[model samples]
Target: MNADNITSDTRSELPQNSSADAAGEKTLKKVANRLIPYMFSLYILSYLDRINVSFAGLQMYTDLKMTDEAFGFGLAIFFIGYFLFGAPGNLAMEKLGARKWISAIMVVWGAITMALALANSIHSFYVLRFFLGAAEAGFFPGMILYLTYWFPERQRGVAVAKFMAAIPAAGVLGGLISSKILEMGGIMGLPGWKWLFLITGFPSVLMGIVTLFFLTDKPESAKWLTDEEKAWLKGEVEKDRLKAAAAKDSVKLFSRETTGSLVLLSLLYFSLTLGMYGFQLWLPKIIKGFGGLSDGQTALVTVLPAIFQALGMIFIAKSAERTGERKLHVATSAFIAAAGFVLTSLIDNPWLSLVTLSITAFGIWGTVGPFWSLGTSILPARIKAAGIGFVNSTGNLGGFVGPYIVGAIKQSTGSFHYGLYTMAASLIFAGLLSFFSERLLKKGTRIET
Candidate 1:
């Protein structure tokens, strides 16, 4: 065809193309609505069961006669199992299907969490924590991979943010409920901490059963979706896969760029987890230090920061999606969190400290959605699951290090100030690394397109 004829033909195709895009978006919205609620519920239960130990530590340490170091070691050991099993677990999920694997993981982890109540000796505590980590290893990364099946890149940031908001939601709910559960101490002659474990653990088991029936492995397999919707979703996914494949010819499973991206992402996540877990595990104790507050009062105080964090995360994720920007969002949030930590440490007033810490919570937790979006955006479909697993697993090692270091500092120094300073520094480093990693990836690397 002549050049003018071809141009005329292409112009005529624009309306049809625009209409198809709109229909695809509508289908995606329906899928997101169907999926996100159930996923969010499962995650809330998962996070609650995993971190309830922070609340349990208040009474369990005294009851078990365990030292700070011992408790810290027990907390840290969970990530060892998490790291070891994470990649393999994700690969297994890719092979076995998300429905079966996610359900199985929840059941096993729930059982382990419940069994934590029976831990009388420090050794038993350590063993149970490790197994808990192993059981829960792939759930988060697997979910991240699973979301890619239903949502295209354009919609993923908001979807991820909505689902991840469950973390902060769990925090708020766990705090409120745990305080009441703790009051149930001596009921049927069981300790409060034991009750906490038992109460929190049961939901996962129930949810796992629900997951078996409710969760579909992929859009192609979803009976609830219309054929048109399925076709559109699948086409979008295939386009992403092809784009990734085209970006790098013969992309190895572990290329230099892949490894570099993994390392940088891991470091970024490590700093985030360090601040996250350290702040969460220590918040109740820190509140108690303000003096004369009952356990219930302390728990109530702890909820404020989580509420702020949930709001911040959702807002930030939406902003990132609207702007189509990732790295700056992640870096800015991390820097805000770093500043919050520093301010918290410097402040003397108890209420002001809590407020500053709330800002810190907002920054660290807020980064989760955009950061994951950034990480997943750069990976090819072939290695996306494994890459996510590597980042999450290695990053979780910070969970171990953060809590343990804080506990050790508390024991030796008689103050949490040093630990707070350390967390602040880690976050600052994370922010800087996040910004530079984007530049590094953009220059002759497949990680940024």
Candidate 2:
């Protein structure tokens, strides 16, 4: 029953899957019941912290006398830090494990987010955004690695899907809250933008508390499980990881193979991100472009896509789950989004365009998480953290580039059509890569080659 004996016994049984009776299966049961929810709560908060800027951007631009380019650059600068520090931060997660490390990260970064209310100039925006990116870099990848320990190859997709849903869900919460907070336009010398930052950022204290109480880095360490239960849990995980390892040559956070795929995916993802982030970072701006929506209406409208996106995530992900197919869902979403972008560009009609955009939001951004789930299938279990981090962090370069890309195009041309078209390729590329990657996985016995 000792921890050492439990781990060794678990490792010894790595290749075996002995059927345990209900009583003997407590370990897997506990993980299923406990760890996923715990991680997800923190994930939701972490994501909210990182993206709170977009909601603030709705008002920040006008108040500070900042231009679209200034907003775009400030948004893009977040990724410069992501690019510079993401890989190293993710590597540290692998070495240090997720519990205490992510605990420290969540607390510090939450404080940083709350600090955003203090920004007075473009200089402040640039600095805060970068450090925020650095603070947030390892989260998604670290979580990806964390998930692999709990679920084997078969279940990892759905597990990841649930977490990925948080992105759109964040939009849902941000939209709902910012609409109310915007009414506080003249509270004690603080702008609505400042309130948005302060209130949203302050919740990390609660999130950090939950993390310290609940987050588990590995199965054997789960106090919720009995020693016998822990052994079985650890055994199942080690076996799955070893099998995944056998499927690839290496699984380091920055492995060459993962980096290669990450590069291609990032370029493609950048384009995809351009469309998604451009819209997210500028949804309020876009809605305002339609004329006469009023502040509250715009806030409500901004959340519409994310709401649709959450539903779209379920519907599309279900189809993927049923068919066990990744490409068609992704492709369909991308093409529909492309069509939405075109309609929004050409139309003078607000109602028609907003409807199209609603579909576009859910259809396009909704598919992102599921597509990421598809990427997990191709990863060997050993390097899942590094592989996903490389993919996510590198792909985020698009997030960094996206707002700027569209903002520049919109500023120069007085329209978003050119930028939309430029980003359209991202949708196409991700689908193509996913389609081919599936083919490659099927034809070969191993995923690493």
Candidate 3:
């Protein structure tokens, strides 16, 4: 059956035949090609802006005469605003639509990031970081929710993964570029960290403006898609929603099972996030501690883990999609991450440490797609927005805790070993919790992949 033979006028009468199935596959590919690269690029900019502070700290901490504890506090405060606003911000996206709300988010956060270059005191650092978190609150979870509006349940793991591959991509790119930017301290009489902020922040603002014109809100409104493709894609998504609705035992927002699943997922994400940010936010400094390495050398070393992470995450998610499983993948990845963390803490050889960090990055990031796939499936549609928001917001508290604890431990003990051990324990807990979480989720309500 030739997909091209399908026409708009015959759309309704076109049976659920092989031709339509082929058309749907082609349509999904078209959507992926059209959206994913652009979405991937946007996320790269978004994550680069968020994590560049890790690199900037090498210079900024010294210039400002800040303690490790104080610097960690500044990093942790961003998540406070992020936690407070995540749910509300997601709800706002639901009302205002992704196009407007996401654009606004990017613009505000970009401006705050640029403003970070002006920080002269710890007080200013704390204030700007908090506002930066508040400004960027819903962008990540909002992108997750936004993907749901396009892709069906089975396809989300790959879609979410491809989008999230940006995290490591950002890490890799930010390291390479930021390392050079840090070398530019005397350029225009401003320090290198200031240059890093200015360079990284401006692209987001430009991309935010582009998003207003570039992004299509939903398939029904996508002009590039033929009416036949649009109808078929929308029908596919609606079928998934209908199946979810029919299978749900209770449609209520606050059902006991629903609430329980949300809580458990939140905790699971908390552990995963703690390990993620703990490693990511401290990676450059961790490498710098190896001795005799310059900032550029430290940044280059940091890129290796991110490269492994980028490759591992995409491959893991794609494999999970093929196997049509999410739970075990997440648990397995978490366990691997725990092992990596433990090994990294114990290793003294710099090269061996880098190898372990790569393993750690691979394992921690490999869980992202499967985790989100499992999460959205467990939560009922009625509570999805708020449920994801609650999970992400509460879970992100770990971001604060991870960096702060690692910093404080480094301050008191003068080593990251205990901090790495703490993160490993949390990952193990997350791995164990995944099995229990699957049990707590309602049997029928879960969207079958």
Candidate 4:
């Protein structure tokens, strides 16, 4: 055909293309509406269960007469089991399917969390925390992999954002509820921290049973979706797979490029986790250090950072999806978080410090969506399960290190300044590392047309 004839023909097909796009959009909205809220709730519970010890630490440490170092060690031990079992747990989920594996994981961890209330010695605390980590190891990465089944790369950022927003939401809910629960100390001869665990742990077990029936593993199996919608969704996801395959011929898990990318991504995540747990686990204590504040008041103030962080992350992830930019978003957020941490350490005014801490929380937690989206985008389909596991598992060691080092610093130095500075330094390194990640992975990735 002549050039003008071809152009005319293409123009004639535009209406059909537009109609198909509209239908696809509607289907995606339906899937997201059905899945995201439920998944979000699961994550919120997961996070609350993971971090509730921060609230409990208010009295638990005193009740046990544990030193700062011992308490920090107890908190850090969870990640040890988390690191060891993380990859295997993800692989188990891959073998068994999300519904069964995730449910089992929730039941196990929920039970362990409740058992934590029975801890009367530091050694018992250590063992329970470690087991808790092992039980919860695969859940986060499993959810990330699950999202890949439903959302294509273009929409994955926002999907991850919505799911991860639960982190901050958990903080808000955990803080409010845990504060009240802590006030119930000595009722029924049990401390309020004991109540916190008993109350929070039950819902996880209930939800685990609910998940078996509620979740569909893949769109093809989703009876709620029409055949056409299922086909369209699968086609979109396949396009992403094809694009990734085309970029790099090798899908070897241990190849130099793949291995290097894994290390870089792990380091990046390590920095984030360090900042996250360092700040989050210690936040209640930090606020109380401001003096003249009750545990309830401190918990209330802690929620402010989470609220701001939730809003910030959602906004940033939406913007990244709209712009189709990932690396810069991750880099910028890390830098912002690092700066906020540094500023927070320098400032003495409690209100101003809280504002800076909110900014820090915004940066630290905000990196979640774009960072994981970028990491997953770089990995080929063959290695996704192993790659995500390695990244999440190794990276979470920072979770152990962060709280430990912070506790060590607090015990020896009698201040949180050095600890905050250490966190700031880690975040700065992560910010710098994002550029290197772009160089390493960007060449192998192309935006889908």
Q: Which candidate, 1 or 4, has the higher lDDT?
A: 4
Error of 4 at 215 (Å): 2.3
lDDT against true structure, model 4: 0.80
Runs with alpha carbons beyond 4 Å of true place in candidate 1: 1-23, 239-249, 253-261, 318-329, 373-389, 435-449
With candidate 1 superimposed using the best TM-score fit, by how many Å does residue 11's alpha carbon deviate from the native? 24
Regions more than 4 Å wrong, model 2: 1-26, 94-96, 243-266, 373-389, 428-449
RMSD of each: 7.5, 6.2, 6.3, 7.6
CA lDDT, every model vs. true structure: 0.78, 0.67, 0.80, 0.80
State the displacement of the C-alpha of residue 317, model 2, in Å, after optimal TM-score superposition: 1.8
Backbone Cα, N, C clashes tallied per candidate: 0, 2, 1, 0
CA lDDT, candidate 2, residue 417:
72
Better of 3 and 4 by TM-score: 3
lDDT of 1 by residue, 1-449 (tens): 00000000001111157789688768877888899999989988888887788888878988889887788878778878877787788689999999999999999999899999999899999999999988887787788778777876556656665676678888899889988887788999999889999999998988898899999999889999899888888988787667666744546658765777777777888887887788777778777777777766777788998898787677777777677777788889989988988888788889998998899888887777677767776655566645765676667778888888988888888877888888888888888887877576647654342
How far off is model 2, as Cα RMSD? Answer: 6.2
Q: For candidate 2, lDDT tens digit of each residue in 1-449?
A: 00000000011122234556453345544566676666666777777776677778778887777777788888778778767776677579778878876877777778888888889888888898888878877666667767777765454555665566566677788778878887687899888888878888777766765677668787677777778777766676688777766755543555544555555444545556666777677777777788887665678777877787677767776676666666566677777777777777777898887887787786676466446555555555567544555566556677777778877877788876777676666666655765565454334533321
Worst 10 residues of 2 by lDDT: 1-10
Worst 10 residues of 1 by lDDT: 1-10
lDDT value for candidate 3? 0.80
Q: Give Cα distance to truth, residue 248, candidate 2, Å.
A: 5.9
Every model's TM-score: 0.86, 0.84, 0.86, 0.85
lDDT string for model 4 (195-313, tens) is 88988998998899899889898899999999999999899889877876765465567886577778888888888888888888988988888888877777778889988778766
